[model samples]
Target: MAGNESETAQRLIKAFQQFRKTGRNEKKIAGFNPSEYRVLFLIQRANENNSEMKVSEISQKLRVTPPTVTQIINGLEKDGYIERTVNPEDRRAVRISLTEAGLKATEQARKTFNETILGLIDYLGEKDSEQLAELLFKVHDYFNQLDNQ
Candidate 1:
């Protein structure tokens, strides 16, 4: 049983490593890398409900540190893609929102991401794609459980 488990583990490791090649040379998914686009998307989602995000809120949601979020925010702000404003209710708190350019970038990124994933789904077939998604979620859950433990 241990030998079989070792072989299975080796196969899983190789499969995970090999899967990195499917990223299209990793040239910025929709004009931004995964981290950047995800931050933009989060702000965009908040904007839809008339809410702006704080650094701490973003950090919590992204499961990263405040400094990391601030670094991304700085780059996005430098590019005029996002803005930080002083909160009216709390002078000490700053809130983040998407700028016009940020909105445009976010929309384009969304379109490209959907198209790519949809293309992958078409290639994978509906059933296999569905199964893959389920299995991936299980993998995610396993890691999450490990983290909690």
Candidate 2:
């Protein structure tokens, strides 16, 4: 079981490395690196859900540190992609939200992500792609369970 898990981990990492190659050629995802794009997407989602999230929330959700989130937020702010606003109810806490430009960038990133995944799905076929997705979810759930244990 351990050997199989190790092999799965290696293959998953290799797959992500290959997937990241798609980002290099994406001219639309300018100014933001892949990680930054991810942060933007998360912020967009959180906003849509009518609940704002702070840098600490982002760090926890993304499994990064508060300092790392702060750094990314700083860059995003400078790029006019996001704004840091103080939470009205909590003056000491601040939330991150996308500016108009940030929302546009997030939309472009979503398009890029969808296109890349669609290309992979076309190559994998519907049946195989579904199976792969299911397996990947199972693997993720398995790891989460282990982490909790």
Candidate 3:
């Protein structure tokens, strides 16, 4: 059993390395790097709630530090992809929202990411793809629970 577990761990590590390498090679869209795209994606998600996101919220969702999120937010703001306003409810908190340009860039990034994922799904076949998604989600949940502890 221990040997099996070790082998499984090794396989998981190799898979992660390969995934990271492949992700790095994915075609860039909207002139954004992967990290920038992630910030845009998170802001886009927050917009779905019909409310602007706070800097701390973005940091939590991205599992990054507040300062890191602020830095990214600063760049996005400078690039005109996002706007920040003082939260009305909390004077000290800043709310972030995507501008029209940000929306366009986010949409383009989403399209490219979707296409790339779909291509991988095609290669994996429908059934395997579904299974992979289920397994990956389970893994994510397991790690998430660990993190909360």
Candidate 4:
């Protein structure tokens, strides 16, 4: 790789570091722990299209064990952020859906996170950031395809 490649990789690492920092601070602001924040993010994304998702599917997407996902789900349920429902296709399967409070929390977190990201994107500017996103998506797709293969 060339110097530009190394520079881009370093920039990517720095970007992730910034995201981690902002994410941690955002959780604090939302009165949620990092683990809970992760669960909320996953649930929010799964429901982005207003679709319900199964616990097993969530576990697979998160690359987390089923028991771990269940444990997190239990905590969220207790906190009233989510509720479990039976899958009609398979009564034995459980699905997770965010409650009103959960949706509100997710929206708040998203707003805060987006503001931070938008600031970064502004600094990177329109064309550069779009190019960066395109390149990063391609890289992500490449690795994902390789994993499946």
Please name the candidate that would achieve the greatest TM-score relative to the true structure.
1
Taken over the whole model, the C-alpha lDDT of each candidate is 0.91, 0.87, 0.87, 0.83
What are the TM-scores, per candidate, against the unseen true structure? 0.92, 0.76, 0.79, 0.65
Provide the lowest-lDDT 10-residue window in model 3: 22-31
Ranking of models by lDDT: 1, 3, 2, 4
Clashes of 4: 0
Candidate 1, 1-149: lDDT as tens digits: 99999999999999888887667546697679788888999999999999878889989999999999899999999999999899899999888899999999999999999998999999999999999999999999999999999
> What lDDT score goes with residue 11 in model 2?
100
**Backbone collision count in every prediction?**
0, 0, 0, 0
Error of 4 at 117 (Å): 1.9
- Ordering by TM-score: 1, 3, 2, 4
Instruction: Kindly report which residue stretches of model 4 are placed more than 4 angstroms away from their true locations once superposed.
Output: 1-38, 41-51, 86-91, 145-149
TM-score of candidate 2 to 2 decimals: 0.76
Off by over 4 Å in 2: 1-31
Candidate 3: give the clashing pairs: none
